[model samples]
Target: MADRSLESEQSWKALDGEQMSALLRGSLNDYGAPPAASAEASERFRLQLEQSDQDPMDAFVEAVAGLTDAVERLAEIAAKDPLAAAASIDPSAADYAEIESLPKPIRMTVRTWLGRLLVRSRLYDEALPVIAEVDATESIDPASSLFYRGACYHALLMKQEALTDLRTLLENEDDCPIRFSRLAKLMVADIKPLKEDSLDEISRLMTDVTRRLDLGRSDEKVEGQEQKIIDKLTKLIDKLEEQQQQQQQQQQGGGSSGGDPKNGQESPMQDSQIAGGSGDGNVKKKNLGDDDGWGNLPPAERKEALQKISRDLPTHYRDAIEAYFRKRATDG
Candidate 1:
């Protein structure tokens, strides 16, 4: 009896390999889960990373990074959707839960991300308190702050105030947001318009680029980038020319033959385009690279960032990116 008891008491130290793999099989096969594929792929990549001898870490990092990145992207998307936001909330009352449970910096990071999400969702007023709280405690970029204020003003229909803020952005800003600059110009253009010289200038820029491309220089690296630049210029010229033609046609037809002032007008944003050396926040700031964000960056760094993002984007997207980012002076 004692010997039998001893045999029964022996430690079971091993797990079956089949069982280990089977345990995860369900999670692996969850075809509905977008995240599972990436997560499992990363796990496989990590295993490979562990076994390889040379340069394994590099491959491991490159491969497995997608798992975390996918999740992060999901998080950002969640932040934008009201349903997602509601789902993430604990639903508990705000019973003085101390944010300081984590380190102060980590807590601040959470608030900042939340604030950014709120901004994107157009919950401008709701976002103000959190952003203001952070700004009170820590330095943020003035431009980012200004942008937030401008967005709020625009949403609230404070057009003149928004315009003032935007013009302030234009004047005090040496390098501005390309998207914002373009939108502002478009809005202002609706009220005023390009001078004949301005139209000629745009035409001349495109002509110069076309000449270069025709000279067998288009395939060169510098020429390719230049071609991209010129493509943007040509689009602008085409639009401006169309507008010029319409204006001439209108004169001949005696002011659209008594049509309403707004009837058949060019889209308020159609003519003007992005400026050179504008802020990058308009395109890749959130998508790639990082910005401490508007109102949180230093003046010099903000100007530098604006300069970098002033790329000649595709014509179709120039105005959309602008309106999406900042309120224009007149339209705000």
Candidate 2:
């Protein structure tokens, strides 16, 4: 009898030709795949093996992709309605309920592939439900399921969950695929320092907004996310301005107020910095950068623009102006 314990310990990374052959045949049998389909898949697997000495994980992924294609085709054939084919292409569609009729092993493989497909398509929200169905430890390719699910989580900004799966993938360094481990490591690093509603979070949200727009999605959800970014930016700017005002106040209180006969050195505390204008009309404009509403400009022009915003605009009006300019830039 074969060593059941040894077979259980066998990692995909260590599988040789004979072992892989047996695995393919066993999986096919377990799924009760048709004889003709089995023959074709076997031939394709043999050709894939011969074409290049691919990593076992790579080979496993290709095999699963093939299985998904076969399953989709089978679903198409079994489907009475012509729309079933279209539904198969969309993960959100209900026609994939046919996959529930498949045997356990086949269903897991199909779901894993669907999860990966949705992630690659940048459909992180749609991918999560499908990916959550597979337990990584029990998956045929643990590394693949773990990495892709973690990736989907990371893309959706689920930091802790992403870190959980990614860190788990890295824990089994010897058994895990090198490519996946490396990517997981990078994603973990990216997610580590992110704090809620901070500028970094807003930047990530901006990136997500851009990604959605690129995908031709301008739905209410996308617009809502955009509004969140604007709100965050407004809060951040308000906090910064508060800090700057406090610093100016501190500097003013420290200086000799009545004996200011200094020649070209402007007063550190200017009435112009205060919230409403004094009759003097001397307002100072803060500097701007790439992140601000103003694009890069000559120092003089930047100063001019900042003066326009700071002098005439209220804080909320400034936010609205920034949002309008941002939308214009995006449209262009």
Candidate 3:
């Protein structure tokens, strides 16, 4: 018998949210009135309460209250021990029939408790109908009902419904509890895009920078601003590379790459110097710094020299440089 009980418990836990709810509804429909054996047990319970000088009606009421309190406690425990709570309640228990006939308010409270418990256990589909019933009746706490329903919709991948409920709670921020309001706001933000097509915009900006630099028509201030944009683009590329590597690692079931090779920490000007001539056997090394003959040119001539140097670098290196300058202009 104990082994059979364990098997039943395992089977219940193995079911999905929809299957669990179906089983629960079926059990409620099939439940019967208290049997002769249970009636005898209740009589003994009443007699024991009477021995303490309690009125018979009061004793019965107290016993019913105690049972309700126990159910409430079990609902709380269900958050962490959903399978245990589900298995603990015998489907054939006689009292379940009486529970089906409970007052409307009491039934709503019970549904609210069960709905939240199912949600906490990650049984979103099972929670939805119960939560919806409570919400339709408008008997349960409004903030709690909204949060649970919103969370269920999110888990079920119904993004629009989730956003609507979450936003509604946020709109009445003063009426809603602080915790629920804050959570709704977080959910809404998470659903929204981080930026408006940022990658495409980055590519377009880089192209514009290349065109401007190619013209070689800039003053000292414009040249400085262009240099800053190049730096920003380099950083953006590094960040995008890191994100790609992290995704690949996750897909491969490996740990993080820890460090990505494409993430360049060196300044664009320094990188360009190294890439252009530092180690190339066929190319003559030239001092790229202002301390070299570069400082001798007038402001306009210096700017033109810098632009010619930028145009001559490899395309990938040039893009990184251009992006850095473009970012500076936007930020400034």
Candidate 4:
């Protein structure tokens, strides 16, 4: 809900090169090398390499494709062998210079897979530069690159930069994978408070509440409460802006006879109270849904009804409703 100018203001700026390099080097040293490939993986790679004799690039692509699959297979074996999945694909085994020399498309693919593997393994700092590299090239699954870069920025405590990237993904990449968009919104919500973008945060929450209501995925009582909060915040912002305009006018009229508060002028606080007090009770009653059906439901009956309906709702929505009730219970 930020205006276009605000959105433009949030554009991403890369971290300082020297600082980023130092951080990556430190993280890599701390993490050390990835565990060597398990025996099964080694044999599979050997066979894959043999098959690639006709085309080395094809073999490399095959190896990259199998990387995640190999980890999953190792995990299955580890369930029984206890040590079978202890090893991971070591990224250092790849010759960076040789990969750099490959065709553009193939090189980008390798970097993309490598970046993803590093991120999945929680080597966020190491993944940061790799993701940035791909992002610079504007190739190799750009959506994934942006997501992982935002994640890396988040992990590194570069929250402003993280918000910039995550917001970009959320706003501009509708065709991006759903999971990435969802995760970006969650991260934005989490980071907004820290950045003091309270209005923007509230706007996002309101948007989400409205969307759920449209989708029939919200509890009536919860939806009403969220709407009430939105209304209250909107009113509050309007009131503050009015006060600001009055102050600015007074400043401009400082040399005029009526400008001085000391000259029998009313205090702004008193003026605001006089203007607002008459409507406060009415606003509160409306927000509390004094005449709404959901507000009239008995607590026990409401809980029972919600539980009965939950079985038919999607898992995500059901979880959201449950969480809402839990929070309300705790708040009460």
**Top candidate, metric lDDT:** 2
Q: What TM-score would every model get versus the actual structure?
A: 0.25, 0.60, 0.33, 0.33
Runs off by more than 4 Å, candidate 3: 1-100, 192-332
Maximum-TM-score candidate:
2
| lDDT, candidate 1, 59-121, per-residue tens | 322332343343243345454773344234322523114332323322333344445556666
lDDT of 3 by residue, 48-164 (tens): 544666533223323334445544444555557754544443346444444445444345445565666777766664577666655423323455666778877765546688887
| Candidate 2: residue 255 lDDT (0-100) | 74
In the range 1-332, model 4's lDDT, one tens digit per residue, is: 74676446433333322332333233223323233432333344445545545322233345433444432343344346422222222234333343444445434544555555656655554566555565423233456557877877765546788987787776554456788888888888877665332444444455446545664565775567585644545454445445555655687676453434787664445334435444445533335444665423355744555566456756664555555556657868
> What's the lDDT for residue 57 in model 2?
41
In each prediction, how many residue pairs overlap at the backbone (N, C-alpha, C within less than 3 A)? 13, 0, 13, 0
Residue pairs clashing in model 2 are none
Sort all candidates by lDDT, best to worst.
2, 3, 4, 1
Total colliding residue pairs, candidate 3: 13
